[model samples]
Target chain A: MQKILNDKLVVTADIVLRIILYLSIVASIFFLGKMLLGPVLGITEYKSGLKTPIEFSVNEQGTATFGSNQTVPVNIEHAKGLFQIDRPVPKTLMVVFFLLNLIFFGLILWVIHSLWMIVQSVRQKNPFIVLNGRRLHIIAFSMIGIELIQGLANLIKMLYLEPRLNFETIIVHSKIHVSIHVIIAGLVILVIAEAFRIGVELKEEHHFTV
Target chain B: MSIRINLDVMMARRKISLGELAEQVGITQANLSILKTEKAKAVRFTTLEAVCRVLDCQPGDILEFIADEKNENE
Candidate 1:
């Protein structure tokens, strides 16, 4: 019964990984298409509209009154100069950014492929092979690479692109928020890869012992 | 590296085939082959005892310790 349950789990995991792999491929293709046709199709403009918070007052009866009952005359700042898509420099930078995104997605696909290989090994009832250990290591390192790329991409956008566009207002709001959980998860995977390496060595020793 | 198994020599002396010795010793022929080929990392006490019993020999008779040439030279 335990064997049956294990088999079922393996199958389910394999199916899920395969689905994710297919989805990643499709998304990558979509991104590639977007990158290729973005300039020609006038989709290169990355617009971030400003949002104003609505002010309201609440009474004891839970009745709310909006600050503006009529059409309010407000000074609107045009952010056209912030993202000058017509400029050659920003256009090239945006293309490069999209290319970096493609590379990031490619790395993700590679990680998924490595994990798929590991699941295949498990399904074969030989998960402790040296190849699986190597695959785990690849997955761990790829995850770290993905995180680094994401951070670098954000930094480039915030530091270089934002300043080049003279967007002081937008730069104040832009911040690089690195996910600690992702780094921790990568470290955990690295440890698991190390364990797999030890397991492979032990398995080889056990095989030769007899 | 010099601790050698004389299982093949003992089996030859006893006029017993590998299969027969393995069957009498209650071990797989493949494992017995590993012992004979001196490829096994270590032998279990129970396996050694069974092998000795099947061959009608002492443990020392089937196992030999030879000094390494490097150690001897040193």
Candidate 2:
């Protein structure tokens, strides 16, 4: 019967959601552990000593500068932007960067977990419940929050951190951009949440009708 | 609060049991119970016609309207 098929489909979707939820939780825990013990365990050395094709050398006066013998490709001029660093980044800065990344990942995991809860309700054939609408609203807002955090982090990197480095110069190929598409997608989800609320009201009315 | 179903009164007058009336009217017992208890929000014309046919009564005999004094005061 069609009812049996629908129930099976919902069960499968529930299983998939549970898998994703477990994965997100494990990833979040791993990131949290790394952030907590990274400084003490000398994990910062691996991240700070990143090797690149471009080399730097120190002069007799102890001034650090880029090596002139480095080969420059013709298309290098058309690259998005240039980021030059004179020295290795400090361990404290690396920890802060990791912390910011962890926060972003946490927000993403929260959105996924909210979706998982909504799907659980759907599997129970109660998709029109008020809690599902609230969960959808949470997902929409979390998506917008993630995009805002990403934009702010980018701005900080461009304005404050980049300028503080002595030999760092970023050639402006394009303006700093925020993802307008993500904001629009969040608005769409918000509208869908409102529609779900109205649907729940209508379903309740129908249930009471003869 | 204004519209009321008089299904139970008509069934009593006709001397018909709930199960007999529901079977003759081609509706479930639970649904007929809802109509008899006046708990239904609205009745369909087809269902009303079936019930009237089964009980040998007019539509007016099964449905009644009474105004609420609270609405008049408001």
Candidate 3:
């Protein structure tokens, strides 16, 4: 059977992978910024309770009103920290998360730089297509693994462990927007893989055999 | 495994300069030089046809197969 394919689609997919590399860079920058500045950002809690005491009996059910501002006393001796966050974040774990975020952020940056080199290789139409593509796809697809695994870990921690920690309702590090990055990374890796495969074939193909 | 490119031989016989041959074949002079030096891994039939036509030679004249210098396993 004869098979026909618009081979240019493969080229377009490679272009899309280049774009995805840029997208990954933007994601890395966001995570890096959060990790760096998140430490200093002070935390405050807002809680309001009935200012009016419960009545023994009333014709109408009691209606509660919250004043503009309410202040609570500081319980300093009960805790041990220089500037403790009133929130439920564990100090050591938060620091670990911060460091891991930096590590992955650096990995993302490395992938971005590699993407630039791959684009250069593609643009120059390098003769050694297999070697060029092998390096590029390794970095490109490895990023997918990194982002997906870390994202899954974050989700699992939020879901299963957060409750066991006696913490408030699930919070922290689970951004809806982050999935856009995961999907983008996966798609970009797939595109790079296809491009690499075709590019090697093209480089190797000749009208006749030896 | 012992096939060889006779492009240089044909080009010499036809007195066609490598630069002129590359220009006729729609490829770079550097690439033509590589092919003449037997440094290229493979060649396209379209390129071979152009060279053959320009040099008044056949594909067989531009390419050759010889016995191995060493054993096949080696």
Candidate 4:
């Protein structure tokens, strides 16, 4: 059978992925540098946006009544659940959030780099190399790291803002949400890495068989 | 490995050069070298038959099983 990588489609895909990887790296570096150094230069604003869920409760009861419960008329003067608060954030918390964002960005770069390397290997018709397996492993772990850092950032933001704000009817709360799909995607990559490892071993064995 | 390929000794006994043997056996010299150097992970029945026919020897002459010293000690 002809190698799939020899096809024009695969060549095009490899070129496209390489371009995307380079662009993502350049853009991430530029944004991360601006976020990290702009404050020191006194050019960046201190305003940060925080998005959290809000529970609404009303004191006035409506005429409609359910079984053992009265309907309360709720007025939403502001945004509803999962609303954003745009204000100045404390420097310490902002710095910590920025650092977390930086780590997440680095993980994203690693994932793209690994994917590009894997595509390059495929283009070379040596897809079952040990290095590709290691790259896949790196990609898997980096995905998990990105998820964990995002969750940590969300938790930190919630913890920092929960006690400081006081509201009569609206409860601003943030919960650390774990994305199961991302974790599963990472696990699928891990399984692909194992398959690549086994393929490499089998290829080596076949190569030596005489 | 405990199972070793004594192909070099057999080739020497038969006075057949590596190039000649590889050509007669219908395989590449690099692959024949791997078998001769005991670096082969496996031997196909067809390849073993061809090598035995070329060397005019039995399978026992090319392959030998030696006890591992570590296993014996354990």
Q: Please give, as one word, the docking class of candidate 2.
A: acceptable
For residue A209, give model 1's deviation from the true position in Å. 4.0
Give the whole-model CA lDDT for all candidates, comma-separated: 0.74, 0.73, 0.59, 0.80
Clashes of each: 0, 0, 0, 0
Residue A200, model 2: Cα distance from true site in angstroms = 5.0
Stretches of candidate 3 above 4 Å error? Answer: A1-99, A114-143, A152-164, A167-188, A203-210, B9-16, B20-28, B39-61, B66-74
Q: Candidate 3, residues A1-210: lDDT per residue as tens digits?
A: 122243354456567777877787787776555544554232333111101111121123233445766544433222211112334444455555566666666667666666666666655566356666666676766677566746654554455443443324322232311456766876787787778778677656641121
Give the local distance difference test score of model 1. 0.74
The DockQ scores of all candidates, in the order shown, are 0.46, 0.42, 0.13, 0.80
Model 2 misplaced stretches (Cα beyond 4 Å): A1-13, A33-73, A78-107, A117-134, A153-162, A168-177, A194-208, B1-21, B32-41, B52-71
Error of 3 at A98 (Å): 5.1
User: What clash pairs does model 3 have?
Assistant: none
| Deviation from native of the Cα of residue A18 in model 3, angstroms | 13
lDDT of 4 by residue, A1-210 (tens): 375545776788788888988898888887767666553233676335455554444344336556787675654444436655565566676677678878888899888888888887877778888899999999999998898887887777667777777787665555686687998999999999999899999999999998
Better of 1 and 2 by lDDT: 1
Q: Mind giving the per-residue lDDT tens digits that candidate 2 earns over A7-38?
A: 89888878998898899889878866665555
Worst 10 residues of 2 chain B by lDDT: B34-43
**DockQ score for candidate 1:** 0.46
Best by TM-score: 4
Q: TM-scores of the models, in the given order?
A: 0.67, 0.57, 0.46, 0.77
Clashing pairs in 1: none
Total residue pair clashes for candidate 2 = 0
Native-interface RMSD of candidate 4: 0.4
